[model samples]
Target chain A: MLHIVNKSPAERNALESCLRVAQGGAILLIEDGVYAATRGNAAENHLRDALSRFKVYALAPDLEARGMGDRVMEGVATVDYGGFVDLVAEHKNCQSWL
Target chain B: MSEGTIKKFMFVNRKAPYGTIYALESLEVVLITAAFDQDVSLVFLDDGVFQLKKGQQTKGIENKNFSPTYRALDGYDIEKLYVEAESLAARGLTEDDLLVDVTVMSRAELGKLMDEMDVVLSF
Candidate 1:
């Protein structure tokens, strides 16, 4: 499976590009990318439109660092670093965009 | 910067190529990592998108334009190239105008992709 990694403000753009081929891939937001959990970012709407079936995840550390833990969008699950390691084990390949 | 059987590596490039040497430095690391026979991929987003634009005039910046170096990425076996779809459109660019061929995707899809990585490095 293809894993999409978002790491910066441009993550919204990166995420959009990966979703074009996300028919069977998953998306995760980490580091500065967690800002998308806040309201008003076009990223939320893009997710609703492109990855209706894939699970959405955010790095817990990044979310807290941005002070957005409470503001995380609905349906977005929080995962810790260990959980992140689990994901890498599950998927054989990944693609990351900053 | 990874251990174990980390066969696949993903590079999240977020900064512009010229302002700092981060992009160039990362490229060197990537090439060395690939020398270990690891699978490598790169996603250009934010300022990183500016790295691939054609006709970069870095002379006034007193820096060498490394755009040509990208053309050689394939030679290093690091060719899973990608770009942010919205970013390209936001900057009024298309794959045709880029120095490389990249697969574009939506934001949500990119998130999922980042989760399934054996190794991830950001620059």
Candidate 2:
């Protein structure tokens, strides 16, 4: 499954809720959720912790748009929209955490 | 998992507009994905109905009004908009209070429609 979180952890509990129920799948951050990919934000530790159990990915366009492109934590992979479509295809289902 | 397959895509909107960016950004995704030519539909439920509320005065906020774009959705071949009856009633809103024409249905009916979808994206 692909767990898509579109909220910034600073603004909502969507990311936390998603992490709890993710059960070893790919977590794709898009929209404002790309803020979580920043190296030293409040959500960084949680995202780092998630890397051990699940594949973490962020939308490249969103990250660049937010000016956090270079601040992404080490292990989170960045993908374009075409890559996003590919991830959706690879996963059996998707759960969007708003 | 295959390319060239058309899927039923339903975008579930549950938040109010302006207060946050979800509503507008979700609309962005809906417009982008519609180019894929899938079976697309949209549902306005909970505070999301407020997004379509008539007489929005966004001029005070200095944000460019995006509500007008909702009117152009049909041009993208994405028009199956739905409003939850219970949500509308809870908010004391009638279909006449909205900016667009939509089929108002019970939550149960919406659930059935949801079950028929191949993909569900909520914002």
Candidate 3:
């Protein structure tokens, strides 16, 4: 399963909830969810724990838009729109933890 | 709606009340869905648990205190209210702080329940 989270962890618990319920799935952070992929955020430790279970990715454009491209935490991959489509195709199903 | 056609509907509420319109709009939709006689359940997580908090006074904000409507959900037969335990603890709230009776479950339990739903609407 591909779990897509778009809400910022600082503002909402969407990312937190997705992490808790999702077991060994891909997590693609987009929109404000990119905040979690950045360094020194409150959710950084939680995201680190998720790295052990899931392959996490963040949208390149969203990170750039927020000027956080250079601050992305280690182990989190960045993908473009085409890569995003490929991820959707690769996963059996997708859930947007809105 | 036909008896055989009723689907399991779960409404996920994650926003705080008064700060935004999502809570009120979601409540209206929940009430309307109840009219159709579907198997409806409401999940209050994150800041959404605040929606069920008791003794909400909105007179200063000039907003109608809709927290009372949650207690009236039983009359509508929409009593499957679930609150996330972690969310309550993070917000310094307990089951006793809420206006209505609700099953407090862990995130894992709620996630399993979500998987069983035929349809889920998030707010």
Model 3, C-alpha of A49: deviation from truth (Å): 1.7
RMSD of 2: 8.2
Score each candidate by Cα lDDT.
Answer: 0.72, 0.86, 0.90
lDDT of 2 by residue, A8-82 (tens): 999886787566534567899999999998898998998999898789999999999888889999999999999
Model 3 clash pairs are: none
lDDT of 1 by residue, A55-83 (tens): 77788888888778877777777889997
Calculate DockQ per candidate and list them. 0.18, 0.15, 0.28
The DockQ of predicted model 2 stands at 0.15
TM-score of each: 0.60, 0.59, 0.78
> What is candidate 2's CA lDDT for residue A55?
94
lDDT score, residue A97, model 1?
56
Name model 2 segments beyond 4 Å from true: A1-97, B1-3
Q: Interface-residue RMSD per candidate?
A: 6.2, 6.7, 3.1
Clash numbers, per candidate: 25, 0, 0
Residue B118 shift from truth in candidate 3, angstroms:
3.6
lDDT of 1 by residue, B39-79 (tens): 88887766778888888788897888878888898888777
Candidate 1: Cα lDDT at B10: 76
- lDDT of candidate 2 over B1-123, digit per residue (tens): 657999889898978999999999999999988998888999887788999998898889998778988889989988899988987998999999999889998776775676566788998
Using DockQ as the measure, the top candidate is 3
